[model samples]
Target: MAKNHLLLSFSFFSVLIIAQISHIFAKNTSKSPIVIQPYIIDYRNGTVTKYYNGPASFVPPPIDSQVQSKDIVIPSPSYHNLRARVFLPARPDPSRKIPVLLYFHGGAFCIGSAFGWGDSHYVAKVAAEARVIAIAVDYRLYPDFTVPAPLEDAWAALEWVAAHASRAGPGHDPWVAQYGHLGRIFAGGDSSGATIAHNLAVRVGMGHGPHLSGLFLAMPYFLGSKRVPLEPKWFPFSPNYKVWPYVCNHCKGGVNNKFINPFGRGAPSIAHLGCKKLLVYTAEVDELRGRAIWYYKRVRTSRWPGQARWIEAKGQSHIFHISKPDDPATTKLIRDLSAFVNSN
Candidate 1:
């Protein structure tokens, strides 16, 4: 029991190290053992407390003057109910058939909440600025579960969103049913969530899911056993590789599994992406930027028969916009997204 306790403590310590990586890798590392407060990592006895949780729902006057939000639970007998934070514009034009977006938050699939400030704030901004109803799917995390589970949770939420457009879809929700365009539904995520977006897109292509008009991959978390130039190591088995398998339940084929390494052997081809439009953008300084570039290239050369574009933000870190929503780069991302979903 004592050894196990030590192991868990060490694991929590490692998470702390990751949270402070942004501080450490910079030119001058802090001499003091200062614990950065970006997140409250209270992992103990097999539970993690990722401190980004925000209000489950927000009203215009209280949260913001532009957007209002509420909570929706997608019931699932297979697992617990998945929580989705729905965001709508404060002032609505019912005559406008705007698009709808389904987003997943990133926590390496082990932590993070849909109601978290980063996801809620970003999605709310998109809903207001881009004239779309946004649903932030709060899927289950790891340690208690693994892949296909999170994927299932995300699909279920997407299905619910798509239902809003189907014959029996009305009454599903006021915002989506009233304003969501029939053909302009989309999905996106940050980091690990981006990886989920890609996988979900593939599932949609396989006749296994609903139609997605487009996908916005923000700093997608695709990894491989092989080393990329920018990657500090071979990734899956590198200094922090344990987190991957741990999040995946030591998934079959280890790090080379199709879920983690989409480009590896026995994996589905990018040529099978079902979406009509895909936007893959990454920050300049993100360690995973190289893989995002690789993903874009694969999609570019594939015969998927879709419009694909790539953008690289100069002098930015991984998911910088999520951490700093007011940044100019974040605004650019939202602007580009608005144009993409509203193009037609």
Candidate 2:
């Protein structure tokens, strides 16, 4: 009877161990999946495929048929696939140098592409309407890469443009060589791209310069660990709550680092902003409007040696201009952007 009891006890313990192992496996598999694949991949054989499993769903055509556009792959030491899409005005005058705009696309630092349909269309329109040489940078995204990676790519693209504009030697982009005016350069973007633009401007302000004339921020994305008035109460606990830390893990101060939240407490003051002029466009209904407005107020009141202006599109939502470029409000915003870029 004692022998029988020992066998039964061993069997019970074995069953318990198996159940525990199964539970652990289920717990792990139940958690949300993290995506690590590239959103869009070019096979170097005239084929590009976009992975739809993640947020990056739109696959831009290889070429923008509406405007004179070309994709140039930037050689990078760290990242092998950095690229930029260059858009030229319909009537680019080789004799007259026009302003240049280095644009970044919005996708929460994770999803969008320079060659995405919306970005391509928007840059093409801006190039045609604003009569400026536009280059949309395709920076590395998150989960696979991280924050400073994108910033580094942006800086690299800017440098490349400056180099091409300064000297149109062999192997230079003809559009940039023919029309790009180095002195009147502008950096602009929407959403997270706007955030990158802001950070880039700040970096430039700290002694580096190709001399930015202006900055165009459309529905700029700025946030902190704490929630502010008019923002959702649960904002602090959202999925993106961890975004700053995840992307900026290398930052010394974590989420509160100057690069993550430039306007937050302890962050470098807006007085360090490099551009001579700042134009901020916000949609009234956008959840991020309040933050942009706050930034405008702070910059305007700060000792920054520049003019800061804000334009609110009533009843509009986040990134409305990019999604609805033909809308009257978007057209107005574009007109304002054109004027801002052309302004002295």
lDDT of 2 by residue, 126-232 (tens): 88788888888889876477788888887877677777755655347877777788888899999889988998898888878456889999998788666666666
Clash numbers, per candidate: 0, 0
Winning model by TM-score: 2
Score candidate 1 by lDDT: 0.78
- Model 1 scores worst on lDDT over the 10 consecutive residues at 31-40
lDDT of each: 0.78, 0.78
Q: RMSD in angstroms, all models? A: 11.3, 6.0
Pairs in steric clash, model 2: none
**What digit string (tens of lDDT, one per residue) describes model 1 on residues 28-126?**
443323221333343434454434454333322228789888887776547677878888888888778878888888878876777767667788898
